[model samples]
Target: MSGQAAIVAHAQHWSGTPYHHRASLRGAGADCLGLIRGIWRAQCGAEPEPLPDYSPSWAEAGRDEALWQALMRHMTPAFVPADGQVLLFRLQSRALAKHLGIQCASGAQFIHACPRAGVVQAPLSAPWARRIVARFTFPAVFDRME
Candidate 1:
């Protein structure tokens, strides 16, 4: 299968993974970023950079756009969201963007590792949609439809 197909398949395979901060083992535990990292490893091999340990509230305590900057270095910004796009969310007003989810093929739904729900597909409801701060596509093969 193609890389984008592999990514989508692998992401779907991670459904029901218990949410664990900083963890990425599929079917065991994964946080929001961990879910993305797992997808990257499945389709793109090793990550470009190692992620440092971070707290759940890291973005709120800092002024730097750490998550945004890191994603910018590896993914391409997309003017519009589509299936397989990385969705960045600013969960609070005046706060740094942090939460992330992969857009599902349907577009109307997204898969994410939620603290309360584990890894699950959820509707792109208005409240969630409004919180999105950026959309990005993974590099090279992941951008294609196959």
Candidate 2:
């Protein structure tokens, strides 16, 4: 397994985790960002900073791209799609980029904690692909070994 594979493996382990807003506990509950947080903890230890409480419509409620700015602070931008990349998505054309998911090993699918389905793997379909606004790699990727 490569470092990216290792990261995806960590995310795969949360496959059945229930979705819970503002929570990160696997199995019990986790939102999309919470799933990313859990994977970060598994691979990089403590989070660089605590996150403020946010509602489901947080991005729409504000014009600021808080999630994108925060991701920039903690991870490296990935110019190409690859396994284990953090994918940021904008649900609407003018909405702030808020949704997140981890690219799976296949690179054609992603794992996300969904409100309706909990943690599930979905294909990188055309519609989903279009929503992707950015990709990033965790800070710990450089230190990880296969």
Candidate 3:
């Protein structure tokens, strides 16, 4: 399957998983980053690197775009939103970009792991769109995956 197809499929497979901070087991629990990590593993074979432990307030306390930096190291920057693209979100006007999701339906909607709802595909509404800090696509190798 193509990367876009593979990502969407993998996300669907993880739907309804319960939210658990720092967890990534499908059908059991997963956080926002866990959801992305799971998709990467499913679509790209293995993770490029191990992740460090982080707290819920890590982003605010660090005062750095750590999550954005990590994504840049593995994925290519995307100028236009598209299917399967990864989205980084900043919950507040001055907050660091931390939340993550996978664009779906040609960017009309996205699939993300909510704290209470777990993984769900929701419309990319105006509120969500305004929070987008950056967009990225997985490396070409991901697109070439079988």
Candidate 4:
């Protein structure tokens, strides 16, 4: 499968999952990280690495980009806009960028797990697009039809 196909599939699966911290099951509950985990599971079988238990502040105790580091360590990076890419964003320019989502529908929109709306497809509005910090994609080998 192509990146777009896998991304579309995972994004759809995340729909209706209630937002729950560190949870990662379709239509059950999950946080941004958990949503990513669920997507990875559906696309690639199992998570490539173990997840760290994190406080709401996460690395605020140490000033490390733990989530960023983890993504780089275990996933493929995408610096440009691409369909099916995973995106990480900081709600504010001065805050820890802890949100995650996946690109969908021609890169004009994305599906993400959120505290307010659980998992849903939302437009990539200018404000939201500007908040994007990093993007990643599933590895080519992970897709059976690739």
Which residue runs of candidate 2 sit more than 4 Å off their true CA positions? 58-61, 142-146
Highest-lDDT candidate = 2
Give lDDT tens digits, candidate 4, residues 1-146: 66668667767877888888889878789887887787777667768887778754422434567788888887888877888888988775566778888888888998887778888899999998998999987765365321
Better of 1 and 4 by TM-score: 1
Q: Give each model a TM-score.
A: 0.89, 0.92, 0.90, 0.87
lDDT tens digits, residue span 6-91, model 2: 88888888899988888898899999999999888878878889897667762474677889999999999999889999999998
Instruction: Give the alpha carbon lDDT tens digit for every residue of 1-146 in model 1.
Output: 75555666777888999999999999899999999998887666678898976678624856888899999999999887678888999988877888999887667888898888999989989999999999987887543221
Quote the RMSD, in angstroms, for model 1: 3.0
Estimate the overall C-alpha local distance difference test score of candidate 1: 0.83
Can you give the lDDT of residue 137 in candidate 2?
Answer: 96
Model 4 segments beyond 4 Å from truth? 56-62, 141-146
TM-score of model number 3: 0.90
Best first by lDDT, ranked: 2, 3, 1, 4
Judging by TM-score against the true structure, name the best candidate. Answer: 2
lDDT of 3 by residue, 83-114 (tens): 88889998877667889999898778999988
lDDT of each: 0.83, 0.86, 0.83, 0.78
Residue 20 shift from truth in candidate 1, angstroms: 0.4
